[model samples]
Target chain A: MHAFYSPQLTISCREVQLPASESRHALQVLRLGVGDRILLLNGHGIRAEAVLDAVDNRRHSTTTCRILQADAAPQPQPHITLFIAPPKSKNIDAVIRTATELGAAAIVPVLCRFGVAKPDLDTIAHWTKTVIAAAKQSHNPWFPEIKAPAAFADVLEAADDHGFFGAVPEPADALPSPAALPVDDQRQTSLWIGPEGGFAPEELSALLAKGLQPLTVGQWILRVETAVPALLAVVLDRCQPHQRETAE
Target chain B: MHAFYSPQLTISCREVQLPASESRHALQVLRLGVGDRILLLNGHGIRAEAVLDAVDNRRHSTTTCRILQADAAPQPQPHITLFIAPPKSKNIDAVIRTATELGAAAIVPVLCRFGVAKPDLDTIAHWTKTVIAAAKQSHNPWFPEIKAPAAFADVLEAADDHGFFGAVPEPADALPSPAALPVDDQRQTSLWIGPEGGFAPEELSALLAKGLQPLTVGQWILRVETAVPALLAVVLDRCQPHQRETAE
Candidate 1:
């Protein structure tokens, strides 16, 4: 079934009108019309089943649907929040989309010593579309909240709960491995990834001083795009085994 | 250090001449001259440290280096071979790059009922560049072998060793979850990912009948690019805890 993001959707509402962009997509691209059943997401926990009730195709088209049933999915366990230093290119969009698909709780763009991207309010608004599209494609009810870009030091100061960063495999490293981080399903997990050249020595020291452990995936140096998904997948898998089994 | 792919590199060689492409990149892009040290990879297991000895920048530029030291990196443990149905778009290139970075043993593009890409000799040659580029960037000494495209049944018949495919989460599913797959670091591992929309019912049944187990990352349906890296990172982490610890 086709899915549309309706942030204002509430279980109490019987009728819903899709946003202008989504309405255009439904009518022109998907060719959806009256009487068609579709899924509606509130970008939180609510996923509602709805049937199209009206299609007002005028200068600015609108499509309204009648709610049939709304199911609220529990937030994913070991909720993951990604604090990443956005790359200097469009790869940040790919990173955001993948993070949403994998069910991250939030995304924070950090400005690091080597980082080049200076994301603003406009950037957050632009990335919000990418998150919604990925959630819709992956059929995920929850959307990751994108926050305003912050300084690296500010991110470190604000970080809370068991956090880990991808450590470049270097000899003489004394930091604890990811396996050493106790997996507590009840606690929120935070992942910090640096820019292309990775975190500087002082930045690393600051993170370690803040008690964030280091994790290594292999010997190779993975780019931000690859490292984010890889680390997110592994960390999420390890942290939520019990929840997954219970769901099964 | 700048790295170049020299498929024929051997430890026994005292001097080596780079391929035309590598020479052009080193001379023009990197602006390297005599006395500069670089790394050379054979795409199998050999990585050599070399110093530039001669630069013949005539009509056809040539770069020769004196081998300083050559080390053979042991192949990644729990050798992973990704037998994937190539997606219709450029995402296949991304898949190959990620697989190479994570140290897969080989990549075999399989033809399935829903698969759209018909990879020919030209396609294989094109993908090889992506593998080399990723390996060079990631500093991975080992490059995965890219084989000719094969039919779905042929892949099943030729498959040997413990295998797992990502299972779509569905109701009334009797298939075993990924956790059920026992970890054996000594065995070669194979992963099969279907194209967009997933495999047909018969294709899934055939895989199950052949004793291939199913793995699940999460409830969301991940695209091939995201799914491949996610599954690879998780499975590789689970399968080779011993090796990682030993390396550390």
Candidate 2:
């Protein structure tokens, strides 16, 4: 079934109206009409089966969907918090979407010493929309909390769990593969990926001082967008068994 | 130092002329003049340092560079062959680039029942160039051999090595995580990822009959571009220890 984002949807509400954008997609793009079944996600773990009750094709169309069933999805365990320095324009969207698909619990954009883009409020809003669209497409019930840009030091101070920073390690300091990292089921895990130029020396020192272990995903240097998903995949793979056990 | 693709480069060559595209990039984009040093790769494990001897600035400019040093990078171990059904226009470039960065030994475009695009000679040429550029950027000496699009059944018939196909497994038949898969250092590993619509029922049956284990990178569905890197990262992580041991 096709899924649509309906942020205000709740179990108590038997009827809901999809947002204008989503309504157009359901009506025009997907050709969904009255009595057509679809799934609805509120980005807060609530997923519902809904049938289109009324379709309005006006410029400001709002489709009313009647809820048939509602259920809460189990939240991802070993909650992953990704601290990333935003790359250039479209690449940031790629990072956000891929991170969402990989089940990141939250995404924090950190401002690093050598970071490329300084994201504005509008950019953050745009990214939030991107995350929501990705969540609906991937059937992810929970959407990652997209935090505003924060200073590297501020983010480091706020990080209180097991933290790993992505960097190409020097030969002598090569870290173990993610699979070999000690699995800690109790604590949440967070990954930090720097921008194209990488973290400056002082920033690296600050991360080390804050007890973030350095991680090398692969030998070759990766673009920021590529590294985000690559690192997340490795981290998620390491945390999968624990998640499965917890789910059981 | 910057790296440029020099497809015909050899160890015995004392001096070489850069391709038109590379020359334009070196002179106009990077503004490198005579006496500038750069690295060159032949996309076949040979990497060389070269000093620009003469640079022409005209539209059809070709720069001459003298080789200063040359070395062969060892090929990646447990060579990976990726058979992916081509996605839409630009995403095909992304798949090839990420596959190159992750050290795939060969990339074969397979035509599937649900595949969207039929790649022609020009598409293949474009994808090959994308791999070359990615190889240079990632400092990978071994460029994956890009093959013409082949029939899905033909690929299945030719597959003899250990094979894994990317698919979201049924809950009752969940496959082991890539990291948990038994490791065999002697055998080359191959992975097959279907197009956006996913493998048809018969295609999945054929893959399973040929003993290709189903593999899921994460819980959520992923786009083709995202899935390529995510899957590669997991596979490379599983293959890392053997690669390190081989390096030693």
Q: What's model 1's lDDT at A174?
A: 71
For candidate 1, lDDT tens digit of each residue in B1-248? 99988876997888888999899999988889899999999888899999999997663368888999998888777788899999864899889988888888899999999898988898899998899999999889888989889999998899874778877766567776554345443357788998888888999999888888787776787988899888888777666664344333
Model 2 chain B: lowest-lDDT 10 consecutive positions: B174-183
List the lowest-lDDT window of 10 residues for candidate 2 chain A.
Answer: A178-187
| DockQ, each predicted model | 0.50, 0.44
**What's the distance in Å from true for residue B24, model 1?**
0.8
Task: Give the lowest summed-lDDT range of ten residues in model 1 chain B.
Answer: B177-186
Q: How well is each residue in A193-232 modelled by candidate 2, as lDDT tens digits? A: 9888578888878877776767665566688768888878
How well does each candidate superpose onto the true structure, as a TM-score?
0.94, 0.92
